[model samples]
Target: MRFIIQRDHLVQSVQDVMKAVTSRTTIPILTGIKMVVSDEGVTLTGSDSDVSIESFIPKEEDDKEIVDIKQTGAIVLQAKFFSEMVKKLPSDTVEIEVQNHLQTVIRSGNSEFNLIGLDADEYPHLPQVEEENIFKIPTDLLKAMIRQTSFAVSTSETRPILTGVNWKIENNELNCIATDSHRLALRKAKVEIDSAAHYNVVIPGKSLNELSKILADNNELIDIVITENQILFKAKHLLFFSRLLEGNYPDTSRLIPTESKTDVVLQTKEFLQAIDRASLLAREGRNNVVKLSTLEDKIVEISSNTPEVGKVVEEIKALSVEGEELKISFSAKYMMDALKALEGTEIKVSFTGAMRPFIIQPINDDSILQLILPVRTY
Candidate 1:
C-alpha cells in the first residue's frame, strides 16, 4: 500500500479511529488500524469487539485533492505508534509506502520512520447492519439526549442491564431513559421517522457517551440504523457501530409517581447553587445527604449536617408553592446532576410525600422528567 496524504487530514482521521482501538484487546490485530487505499479515497478502520469506527478521506472533495494514492492496497499498522507519528509529523503532507514482508515507511518533511505492518486480512470484520430500519435525527438534539441520560446509568455491573440506557421510539417521538436505582434521567424529542415502525434498543451508556463526544453540535441530520444486535450511526464521512446489550431493560414506566402532596416552582440557578453550597458539608457525611424544606410564604430551606463537619442552611424564595408543606432529604450529588441536565430557567419539583420518589422537571416542558429517590435522614 502506498499513499501521500495531507498531514492534518490524516491526523484527524487517525484520532477518530483511535478511539476504538484498545491495547489490551484479546485479538492481536485489533490493536492495529486497518488502512485501505482505493481508487476513490483512503479508509481507516479501528475496532475492539464491542465498538468499531471507520473514517473515509476521499481523494478529491469539491474539486480539491485530499489524498493522492500511488498504489491500491491495504495494510494494518500499530495504532499507538502510528497515531503519535502522524500527529508529530512536521510537514504539510505525509507519504506512506509498504514493501515486502509487510514493512512500512512513513515520511514527512525531514523525518522518516519505518514501522512493521500486519496483514489486513487478519483483522476481524466489522459487523454489518442493514439500513432497513433507519431514522434521522438532528446531531445537536441527539447529543443533548445522550448527555441528559447517560450519566444516570448504573456504574455497578451486577445488574448488567442497568448499565445501559433504554431508547424507545414510537409515533415520531424518541425517548431515552437511564437510572441507577437511585436517580433517573429522561429526555424526549420529536424526530422524523416511519411511524409504522417501532424500536426499543438498549445501548451501553459508555458507548453512547463516546458517540456523543464525537458528534459535532451541528444542525445537520444524522442517519441511525438498527439491526438485531448492532446499531450504526452515520454522520458525514464517519461511521460508528456499537453492539447492543443482550438482556431486557427493566420497565421504568411504573416507577414514576402519579400524585404529589407538595409542589414548588423555583429558579433553577438559585436551587442549584444552594445545593452546591450545602453539599460541601454533607459530602463529608456517610450518604452526602441534603435536606430540603418548604416554609411559609414560598421560602425553600436547604440544609445539611455532618457529625464531624459543620452544618449549612440556606433559604431561597420560590416563585410559587402549592399543596402541603414538605421536608425531604436526598443525595446532594444526585440533585446537582439532575439540575445540570435541566435546560430551563425555572423548575418545578413535585413531591408525593417525604419518603416517596420526587419528580423534577421544567415548568412548561413535559417532555423531560427527572426522578430522585429521597434519602432518609433520621
Candidate 2:
C-alpha cells in the first residue's frame, strides 16, 4: 500500500478514529489503526469491540487532489505511534508505503520513519446495520440530547442496564432517558424515520459521549440505524458503530410522579447560584445535601449545615409558589447538573412531598425534564 496524503486531513481522521482505539483492548490488532487505500479514497478504522469508528478521506475533492494513491492496498499500523507521528510531521503532505513482509515507511519533509504493519484482514469487521430501521436527526439537536441525558446515566455497573441511556422511539418522536437511581434526565426530539419503527435500545453512555465530541456542530441531518444488537451513526465521511447493551432497560415511566404537592417557579440562574453557594459548605457534609424550604410571599430559603464546616442560608424570591409549602433536601451537584442541562431563564420545580423525588423542568418547554431524589437529613 502506498499513498501521499494531505497531512492535516490524515491527522484529523486519525484523531477521530482513535477515540475507539484503546491500549487495553484484548485483541492485539485492535490496538492498531487499519488503513485502506482504494480508488475512491482512503479509509481509517479503529475499534475496541464495544465501539468502532471509521473515517474516510476522499482522493480528490472539489477538483483538488487530497490524496494521491500509488497502489491501492491496505495495512494496519500501531495507532499510538502513528497518530503521534502524523501530528508532528514537518510537511503539509505525508507519504506512506509498504514493502515486503508488511514493512511500512512513513516520510514527510525531512523526516522518515519505518513501522511494522499488520495484515488488515485480521481486524474484526464492524457490524453492517441494515437501513431498514433508519432515522434522521439534526446533528446539533442530537448532540444536545446526548449532553442533556448522558450525564444522568449511572456510573455504577451494579445494575449494568442503568449505565446506559435508554432510547425509545415511537411515532417519529425519540425519547432519551438516563438515571442513576438518584437523578434522572429525559429529553425528547422529533426525527424523520423510514418506517413506523418502535425501537427501545440501551446505548452505552460512554459511546454517546465519545460520539458527541467527535461530531461537528451542524444542522445537517445525520442518519441513524438501529438493529437488534447494534446501532450505527452515519455522518459525512464518518461511520460510528456501537454495540447495544444486552439487557432490558428498566421501565422508568412509572418513576416520574404524577401529582405535585408544592410547585415553585424561580429564575433558573438565581436558583442555580444559590445552590452553588450553599453547596460550598454542603460539600463538607457527608451527603453534599442542600435544603430548600418554602417561605411566605413566594420566597424559598436555601440552606446547608455541616457541624465541622459551617451553615449557609439565602432567600430567593420565586416568580410564584403554589400548592403547599414544603422543605426538601437533595444533592447539590444533582441540582446544578439539572439546571445546566436546561435552556431557559425560568424553571418550575414540582415537589410531591418533602421526601418524594421532585421534578425540575424549564418553564413552557416540556421537551426536557429532570428529576432528583431527595436526601434525608434527620
Candidate 3:
C-alpha cells in the first residue's frame, strides 16, 4: 500500500479512529488500524470487538487534493505508535509505503520510521448493517440527548442491561431513558420516520458517549441504521458501529411517581449552586447527602451537615411553593447531575413524600424528566 496524505487531515482521522481502539483486547490485530487506499479515497478503520469506527479521506475534495493514492492496497499498522508518530511529524504531507514482508516505512520532513505491519486480511470484518430501517436526527439534538441521560446508566457490572441507555421509538417520537436504580434520566424528541416500525433497543452508555464526541455539534442530519444486533451511525466521512447489549432492559415506566405531595418552582442555576455548596460538607462524610425542606412564604432550605466536618445551609426563594410542606434527603451528586442536565432557567420539582422518588423537570418543557430517590438519613 502506498499513499501521500495531508498532515492535518491524517492526524485528525487517526485521532478519531483511535477512540475505538483499545490495547486490552484479546486479539492482537485489534490493536492495529487498517488502512485501505483505493481509487476514490483512503479509508482507516479501528475496532475493539465491541465498537468500530471508520474514516474516509477523499483523494480530492472541492478541486483540492487530500490524498494522492500511489497504489491500491491495504495494510494494518500499530495504532498506538502510528498515531503518535503521525501527530509529531514535522511536514505538510506524509508518505507511507509498504514493502515486502509487511515492512512499512513512514516518511515526513527530515524524519523517517519503519514499522512492522500486519496483514490486513487478519483483521475482523465489521458488521454489515442494512439500510432498510434508517432514521435521521439532527446532530446537535442527538448530542444533547446523550448528555442528558447517559450519566444515569449503572456503572455496576452485576446488571449489564442497566449499563446501557434504552432507546424506544414509536409514533414519530424517540424516547431515551437511563437509570442506575437510585436515579433516572429521560429525554424525548420528535423524529421523522416513514415506517410504523417501533424499535426497543438498549445501547451501551459508553458507546453513546463516544458517538456523541465523534459527532460534531451542528445542524446537520445524521443517518442511523439499526440491525438485529448492531447499530450504525453514519456521519459525514465517518461511520460508527456499536453492538447492542444482549439482555432486556428493565421496565422503568412504573418507577416514576404519578402524584406529588409537595411541588416547588425555582431557578435551575440557583438550586444547583446551593446543592453544590452543600456537597462540600457532605463529601467529607460517608454519603454525599443533602437535605431540602420547604418553609413558610415559599422559602426552600438546602442544608448539609457532617459531624466531623462543618454544616452548610442556604435558602432560596421559590417562584411558588404548593401542596404539603416536605423535607427530603438525597445524594447531592445526583441532584447536581439532574440540574445540569435540565439546562433550563426555570424548573419544577415535585415530591410525592419524604421517602418517595421525587421528580425534577423544566417548567414548560415536557420532553425531559429527571427522578432521584431520596436517601435515608438517620
Give the better candidate number (1 or 2) by lDDT.
2
In model 3, which residue pairs have backbone atoms overlapping below 3 Å?
none
Predicted structure 3, TM vs. truth: 0.98
lDDT string, candidate 1, 244-269, tens digits: 99888889999999889899999999
Question: Clashes in each model (backbone N, CA, C under 3 Å)?
Answer: 0, 0, 0
How much is 176 displaced in model 3, in angstroms?
A: 0.3
Q: Per-residue alpha-carbon lDDT of model 3 for 1-378, expressed as tens digits?
A: 788999999999999999999999999999999998899998999999899999999999899999998988999999999999999999999999999959999999999999999999998999988899888999999999999999999999989999999999999889999999999999999887865978999999999999998888798999988888999999999999999999888899999998898899999999899999988989989899999999998999999989877899999999999999888999999999999999779999999998899999999898999999999886
Where model 1 places Cα greater than 4 Å from the true spot, the runs are none
Tell me, by lDDT, which candidate is best: 2
Q: TM-scores of the models, in the given order?
A: 0.98, 0.98, 0.98
Per-candidate Cα lDDT values, in order, are 0.92, 0.95, 0.93
- Model 1 clashing residue pairs (backbone): none
